[model samples]
Target chain A: MTLIETILSVGFVAQALRVTVPYALAALGGTLAERAGVVSLALEGMLLFGAFTATLGSALGGPALGALCGIVGGLLVAAVYELIVVRWRADQVVCAIAINLLVLGLTRTLLVLVWGSASSSPRVPGLGSTGTWAFVAAAAVLALALSELVRRTPWGLRLRAAGERPDALASLGVDVERVRWGAVLASGALAGLGGAWLALDVGGFSDAMSSGRGYIALAAVVSGKWRPLGATAACLLFGVAGALELNLQAEATSLPRELVQMLPYVVTLIAVSSVARGARAPSALGQPLG
Target chain B: MSWDRGDSGASASSSHGGAWTALYVTLVALLVALLAASLLVIAFDESPARVFALVVAHTLGEPYGAGQALFRATTLVFTGLSVALAHRAGLFNVGAEGQLVAGSFACAALGAALPAGTPAVLALPAVLLAAAAAGGAVGAIPGVLRARFGAHEVITTIMLNFVVSGAVLFVARTWLFAPETIHTRAVVPGATIPALGLGGSAVSWAAVLALACALGVTWLLTRSRFGFELRAVGQNPDAARAGGVNVGRMTVIAMAAAGALAGLAGSGTVLGYKHYFEKGLGADAGFTGIAVALLARGNPLAVLPAALLFALLAEGGLAAGARVPREIVDVMLAVIVIVLAVAAAETRRVRASAGDGA
Candidate 1:
């Protein structure tokens, strides 16, 4: 089939939706956090931790318990983050980088200690036949739900105020810190769901499996201008790039695999750097509140 | 060296106590990191005190270990200074790994192409300049993108890393490899850096060059008018632009300079140690620099001690890993970074409550 025809084909659309699951879920969570003025650099770490716990929990029970365990794992990371960045008021970007490194090392160590392998764990009974279709549907629902809730709810109004001007929230007797905490934790839970989906899809956990999806999700949040719907769509754009790369890899062309592997990042860079004119970030993003 | 990245004057945490505060924060962070690390070891059924002692002994107590620590610190010093310089201009250059790759590739490629048995005088400077130019060009990419296209330096630099690595990989695999190996052909003996004769270790004249660069960077950042404007840009780009400073130009120049510094770190691995450009030659040399630069509080001169400390832990931690896991050392390093950030915040709070600089 021609490239255009292939892109419009049902098979390609299904492949694209499957590829976009992690990015869509993580980006939606990121939008919520960035809208509340947190940079959410810990998304990558949370995803890794959540994936790990999901695998571990699956080994103990099944996908149902595994999902709960994954979220709790993500919340564990969020608790530490809150302590460092919010409670102690450290530089958000700095702390986020530190926390990411810590997670990378800790997860590797845990894998070695628990599974006797530093690279990957043994297979476990995880999310079986339904596959990423479940997460794809869930992410779409959450994205639209978040869009409406932010537009209509009082909590969403307070979230916007916290991001745009925490001082305004404070003047109105709203606990800005509480709102930030909630936003960060909520972001963590959603990212955790992404992680669980990832582990369940593979039926096991691998070292650095989340790779840079957390970061890609951050790009989606920025390019989407911190709106849930916009961010989800941006993630779908990345998914399109992934699907195209995969299709090209499977074709008869002699394109280099290394170059093919680089397609998504190239697309992301161009997309992010190209439209800097209209993208406005939350004012208090990455700043430590007084 | 300021960490005051447009904090809206609400928390000038990095600037409160100057040298004393930096010293206090470093020590406190070390203590906290050690205590936390010890707790981790105890939970894993290992003795923290023994692990600490073993690490120190392996890294500092013996001549060979000392040489290894200094060897590792050599690359880190270059990269630490690289990160610290850009940081002083309020940009985080996370692509040091790629920049180093470019430099080493250029350095090796040029060195191999030199005339057989060429004189060191003409050969060395030409090869070194090639390294710096290649690295600087790679580094300038993110700078140019951010300056002209308004890309976030952090993201652009990271994306550039994967792009550069892939490009280099394709090039190396296609034409640059010596045979079936990952490295290029060995450079001529004239291009090799003289070893320092520390018990046959890889430590070489690059150590001396690292020190020289640090001294040069310290002077450049403090004495030059360039340094003044760069610091101004870092502290507040808006104010600096208001005061007639070219913020975008400074940002680009700062990133390029930082990339050059990181690129020069390849000298130790290529000319001094392997005599060829190997894939993954500068392992963790780029990322570890971030920790080193942060530990140095963005100060060019202070990077020396901070790099030394990290090198000891890394080398010593490997030695200690016979009984204790080496990843624990990574965890400790991360804790140090987090604690130092918290200390910066606390310092600002103390100064605020004290009615002046505390």
Candidate 2:
């Protein structure tokens, strides 16, 4: 099949839609966090924890229970992240990496302790078609909602002020830290839901299964210019790239598979470098209050 | 754009005899990590004390264990220094993993191309230099991109890692890799660094090279005019530019130097130990190096002790696998980083407040 035809095929389109769920959700969450000036590097760890807990929760009950547990898992990681980055004023980049590493190690340890296997959990009841479709709709809706929230809401104004001008917010008798704290927890919950959906789609959790999706989501946020709907759209574009990669790997004998695997990241690099030229980050992003 | 660069060692080394305070903070951080991990151990119905004993006995009490830890530490020292230099230049380089692999590939490619009868004196330096150059080239791509195009180094460096991974795999499969293995052919004897690991261990003279590099980086960052410019840019780019420093040039040079240090990590595993390039050899060294650099607080000279500590923990993690999950060591590493960051920030706050009082 020609490249266009292959991308337009029902299977390809469906796969793209399916894969885009995690990226979109995470990207939206990242948009929210970055818009509030938090680095949100721990989004990766939050996703992993959400996946593991969702799988574990599924084993205990059903998809609904698992979904709740996933959000809790994400919140737990966020709380720790906020404590370090906000309360203690630790370096955001370092703290984010630490959170990711801790999750990687902690999950593997938990897997060994619980399942007696370090590779994967025994197959549990996944969210299946219904849950996935529901998440897809939810991601789209949340993106729109986030846009509105940032545009019209008083709390959202506080969030923007906190990121762009902390001193201004402080002078207005508002707590900048409190606004940032709210934004981070909210982002964590969104990212956790994204992770839970990932696990539910597969019916189980595997070691480091989130792989580099969290980073990819971060790229989406940057390329999307930290806007909710824009980031979600970027996620969809990446999802299409991923789908095309898989299609090419299956049909094209001349193209190397390794080259195909690098498609999304290469695309992200191009997009990010282009976007960064004129884009401005939140003024307070990654800076501790003086 | 704002970061601390983890300068715990700065105040300590500068004045008021803060070295002891820095040491105390590190010890306390380690203690905190141990205490937290011990709680997890008890939750899992294991003996923290026994696990600790196993870790000590395996990594320090036996020559084999010591040699293995040293082998790991050799690579980490190189990578830790890489991260440290980048941090000192106000850049967070996440591409050391790719840089090391690129170096290994170059080292192996040159070794395979050399005549089998080539002399050691000619082959060794050629192979080593090739490795460094390849790594530096990889490192420079991100630097150039950031300097000229306004791309963020953090994202671009990471993306380069994937690009490098794909390119390396393609090249290896076509002309380099041995049949059915993800490794390249062994280098000719002339190109191989002599091994010196104790107790049948895999370490080589790479340990000595790592130590030399540490001292060299320290000198470069402290004594050289170029180093002064780099640090000035790191502290405040606008002020440095006003002072006539080329911030862009410093950024590129610093990144290349960082890549070269990480790239030299191949000297330990590929040149000295395996005598060939292998996939997965470069994995985690960069990340673990980040942990080491943070613990060292970006002090190049202190990377030795920090890398050794991590290497010991790595070996100990495996040794304790009989009674507990070995992955706990990674958790410990993360905890150490987080705690160290908080401690460094706290110290800075205290100093800032005290200065205000003065």
Candidate 3:
């Protein structure tokens, strides 16, 4: 309420950065797929499966091994989605929803059968154990590198062309499916990293840890016009909103946390509506490639 | 989007028979998966035979279990109809969860505020109408925004789901919550639907009402003039606009109607089953509606059976207990939906090829 109190709130803002790290990572992944002409709605399930695998791997193996397992798990799931939607020309949206549902069941089943727990795993080696800020720094650097790669690389141009006009890309002798496949795989990997960060970096696995962050990442991807740097900025803004809400709740602040919590979603929607208007999405974002 | 089913070996006069075959195959495949899943449980040093038997005995083998299944189906019917209706207008109504929750809040508030002296006939419709208005308004927001600004409906609807959930949760805690319990005060008896006592379980006439609503929507879509226009707009908006159909108006109307269906679901929860609104009551209603609509291929009549099947699986999953693991139902549902999506995609491709040839 006072100037000093408002200045002290900066600490909570810093705290929110911790929450934003995973979201930024996930949104970055979504940005890749969307840029490549695929609406990867399976991010939610991919995140969940990745988290479960990472938790299981760390519980059985080490945290490093768990992270690798998560990446592999994400790739495997993405492969299935790509095969059905891209290769077989299935409805991409429904395929993504199916992946979400299938993984929800499979992951919950795995939790009960393997870990004998419903929501979480035993505390294993975690990113927090190494250093809390380490994961955040790594993510930011990855975001910057990927952003540059997307804008500068020949491969990025081909990927963009594939999304823009697969038929035209095919006419130019570029295998559109192959390019899209690579993008899908990359998207999965990034989402997996986000999931691993949530489970290993943040805390042990929790059933709803991903919550709707995967969906929010979709919002971020749209709001950012499928650009990596733009998405990173959007994710940070959302993260700050989340951080503010948590801190408000913590200090028993009289202001309604729910209303504050609504801010991120509202902002994301507005950002998406504004950004998506002029910016062209992947011409065939939701369409299955023949 | 009519299918000939000519690829099947059925005669022209018997083409309707091919539909029956597809339906049968889908059901059989689902059952086989359930069987295989249950067998896996047995392989895990558990008694597969016992678990399978228990699931059947509990879900289908008992009278009470069937009643509960119907109750679950009643809620899903509204959601299924909601999604199906939107699909008919080529709109994805992903905000059903939010609309449902909003409806629940309104139903709760109205149910609480109404006097005990009001007649049941007058009060029941009032509560339902309040819910429909609330839910329909929520559904219309994305539709109206999209119509006016060309803003994408999918993202806005999804975002709204969270907003509605959070808003309702806040309302529940601050305004509608009873002094004692965390939930809202009980609705006046006049506002509640009378439940039928069957096999020691209370069966809400809501199922009958749901059936009537489903039938009403089906007839409206297939037989009514507006239904023809909505379908035309759904199939090809540009073409529909060329033909004098107001694409934007149809989108809003269809979405609003869909929202009313979902709202009815929430109202049913308060008026038929629970007397008060609770958090997490929606769980996965909106998401599940996607699967339901896909399974039905946007056919309102087909949605009834599709929703019923899903409801049975959900209810049966719980009754099946530790052996089946409730998640198994989700697995079956996911597979079924994916299969349907693939089928629909294939159908579209084949139709496109035919058009090209023409």
Candidate 4:
């Protein structure tokens, strides 16, 4: 096949789409939380926990239950985050970092306890091809739904208010804390789903399998200017990069694998820096509510 | 608003009080972290008190353990100072990890190139300087981006980390790859730091250097004019710029300085301990430094004790790995950082309310 034909192959597109799913889902979730003014460096930890719980639940029950368990795991971490950031009013970034560390240790400990190894879990049932397609469609629907929710709905208005003008929102008798808590919880659930998609697709969990996808998702959130559709597009763009990298790895490229591996991160850095000037975060994004 | 001699005395006393308060809060946070860690131990079906005793004995009671703790603290001290220095300039330097890798790579590359019988005075300084310069250059990328493009330092630094990690691996494979192992060739004998005579421990002169650097950083931050400007920018950039301080220049300098410190950390691992550049060395130290700095409340002098505490925990974790997972130490570190963050915020809230009341 010609180079162009190879590049445009149906298999390549499918693979790219597959890669895009988790990023799109996680970025959308990040958008929800950041829109409500919560910084989420813990997305990595949340993703790992979700994957671990999903694997464990799959082993115990089935894929459906595994996904549900993943959401719960994410929610548990999110609750701790809320307690620290919203209730105690800690520095959001520091709290997020702490959460990431805590979850990492917790997941590793649990993995060793249950699986008898810290590396990878035993094979479990996964969402088959049909479920994968369903998830992709659901992600697309979520992107559109969230975009509408943020732009057209009153709840969206309140969430934006909680992020940008918490005092004003509080003065209007809307509980800013409640709005933020809801957003954070929903965000966790979505991120958990994304992570579950990763594990179920692979039929098992590996140590550090999420592997900085959470940070990349955050980059997408920034590059997309905190908009749902924009973030999804950014995720697709990264997914394409990832797919290209994989393609290159298969071919006999003279470039070292390490340099090729760096392509996505370099692209992310450039994209984030370029779009940073155009993007404006919420006015009170990282501030504790007074 | 008054700039009088009498006000200077009052201000000094107030600052002292603030330091004391930070110390007290940090102690309380440590206590809370230990309590949480104890609960984790209980969940593991072990007696928390017994585990705690074992950890303490393994970390501090034995001479070899004490030396290992000090060795670990030597590296943490540099990275902790790196984070603390950047924090003073209002920059969250998440790239310390990358900078450290760059430094270690530089040290290994340069030390390997040195002639076998070169003098220690010449070879040692060359490798150290090379590492610091490389790390500073890597660090300056995010600094420049932030200063010139208004890019958020946090994002840029984090992105740079992956880039650095990948680049380091590529370079190590292409230029410094050892045929049999995943690490580079050992440094020349002149380049290797001599171990301190500490009961067969791997402790080296890096510990002394770390302490000296800590003292140096404390003086630089507290007594120097540059430090005053850096702190001003951290407190309020607009005010600092309005007062004729070059905020942009200071940002770049602070980041570079922070990166250089992290590079020194890499040097401690390579020159003082490993004597060769390995792929995974000094990776976790960079992240752990954040916890150390937070616990220290960004005080350079306080970093020593904070790093020592973390080092003890790390050593203790390894020693007690059979009974309790070493990851529990990481949980404790995270808990401490979170508690300190909350405590710091609470103090700020109280101070603000008091100002309003006044």
DockQ of each: 0.65, 0.69, 0.52, 0.54
Q: How high is the TM-score of chain A in model 3?
A: 0.91
Q: Write the per-residue lDDT of candidate 2 for residues B1-358, one digit (tens) a residue.
A: 1243333234334324367876897899899889978987886898899889889999999999999999999999999999888888888888898899899899988997899999999999899899889889999888888888778888788788888888898889888899999889989989988778498887889899999999999999899998888888777788889999988888898899999998898788888888888777778888999998878777899899999999998988889888888889889999999988888778778877987999
> Interface RMSD values for the candidates, listed in order?
1.9, 2.1, 3.2, 5.1
User: Candidate 2: lDDT of B14?
Assistant: 34
Question: Candidate 1: where is the Cα deviation over 4 Å?
Answer: A1-5, B1-4, B7-20, B356-358
lDDT of 2 by residue, A1-290 (tens): 68888777898888898889888988888887787888978889999999999899999998888888888888889899999998888878889989999999999999988898989999988886778778888888899999999879997788888889998889999988888889899988988988898888889999999977888899899888888888988999999998888788888989998889999889888888888877788888876666
Docking class of 3: medium
Tens digit of lDDT per residue, candidate 4, span A1-290? 65467669998888888888888888888898899988867777778888888888888898988888888877877788888888888878778877888888877777777777878899999998898898889999999999999999999999899889899999999999898899888878888888888899899988778878888888899899999999999998898888888887887478689988888888888888888888998877877787
- What's the C-alpha lDDT at position A256 in model 3? 76
lDDT of 1 by residue, A1-290 (tens): 88899999999998898788888888887888888888877888888898999899989998877888888888888888988888898878778777888988888888877897879999998775564567778888999999998778999999988899998889999998899899889888888888887898789999888877788888888888788988888899999999999998898377877788788888888878877658888888876677
True contact recovery of candidate 3 = 0.60
User: After superposition, which runs of candidate 4 have C-alpha atoms over 4 Å from their true positions?
Assistant: A1-4, B1-15, B18-20
What tens digits encode model 3's per-residue C-alpha lDDT throughout A1-290? 75347536767666677878878888888888887888878888778878878887877777787788778777878888888788877767667877887888877766677767787666877764455577688778988988888899998888888778888889989888998899999888888877887788754787666777788888788777788988888888888777766666766568676776787788767777767666667776766676
- Give every collision pair in model 4: none
Model 3 Cα lDDT, one tens digit per residue, B55-161 = 67876888788877777777788898898787777777778888998888898789889998889889988998999899999999888867776667777888899
Candidate 4, residue A232: how far the Cα is off, in Å:
0.9
Residue A34 of model 4: what lDDT? 90
Global lDDT of each candidate: 0.84, 0.86, 0.77, 0.84
Candidate 1 CAPRI assessment class: medium
For candidate 4, lDDT tens digit of each residue in B1-358?
0011121222222335566786787788778878987888887788988888898888778889999998999989999999888887888878889999999999999999899999999999899899889889888888888887777787788778889989998989887878968899999999988888676677799888889999999899889999898888777788889999998899899999999999888776799888999888886888899888877767788799999999998999887788878888888888888877777667667766987999
Model 3, C-alpha of B296: deviation from truth (Å):
1.4
Candidate whose TM-score is highest: 2
Candidate number with greatest DockQ: 2
